[model samples]
Target: MANLNPYLSFRTEARQAMEFYQGVLGGDLEITVFSEFPDMVQNPDQSDLVMHAQLTTPDGLVLMASDTPDGMPFEPPQGFSVSLSGNSTQRTQEVWDALADGAAITMPLDTAPWGGTFGMLVDRFGVPWMLQGDSE
Candidate 1:
């Protein structure tokens, strides 16, 4: 089966952002630094930058990210959000609260028109997320 995962790019915050996500999402995180790959080492100043980071949550969610090498243009994510839906309402609310730390809430998590809890927020790492609680 094929899988589609969100790939995020950060200027130099990939390591921090991915680590934060691991804490919030409770996952196994594997990271590789730019210095680890000699061929990919473009700037010594950014040698510690995360060349690749992947977090796989126990719920089967996978997120991947990398830092933009120095001398390359970096733009924060916009226009799209990483949407999360959970089977358990309690777990869903737990995640929402965790992500709400230092987040800019675009919408308060509350009863939606469709009767499910829904909300939007941009986390401190500048990543946007939409959370939906149990549909039923």
Candidate 2:
């Protein structure tokens, strides 16, 4: 089966962002630094930059991220969101609250007209998210 997962790009904050996500999503995170790779470090300063990071949630959600190489252009994400949807009201609300910390809320979490709880926000790392709970 094919699956679609979000791959986030960061300048030098991939490690922080992945850790934050793990805390919010209850996941195990694996990260590799550029220094870990053979001859991949371009600059001494960038040695500790994340080359790759993956967060796998208990529910099978996988989020990947990496820090852009020094010569590559870095653009923050826009025009899209990492949508989280499920039937667990408690878990949904917990995620929403966790992501709300240091986030800019675009839509407050509340009962939506569709008969469920819904909300939107951009996390501290500039990743947008939409969280929706089951119909009530």
Highest lDDT against the true fold, candidate: 2
How big is the RMSD of model 1? 1.2
lDDT of 1 by residue, 73-96 (tens): 988899899998864667778888
Model 2: per-residue Cα lDDT at residue 48: 90
Candidate 2 to native Cα RMSD, angstroms = 1.1
Candidate 2, residue 44: how far the Cα is off, in Å: 1.7
Cα lDDT of model 2 by residue, 66-122, tens digit? 999788898889999999998576778999999999999999999988878999999
Model 1 TM-score relative to the real fold: 0.95
The per-prediction tally of clashing pairs is 0, 0
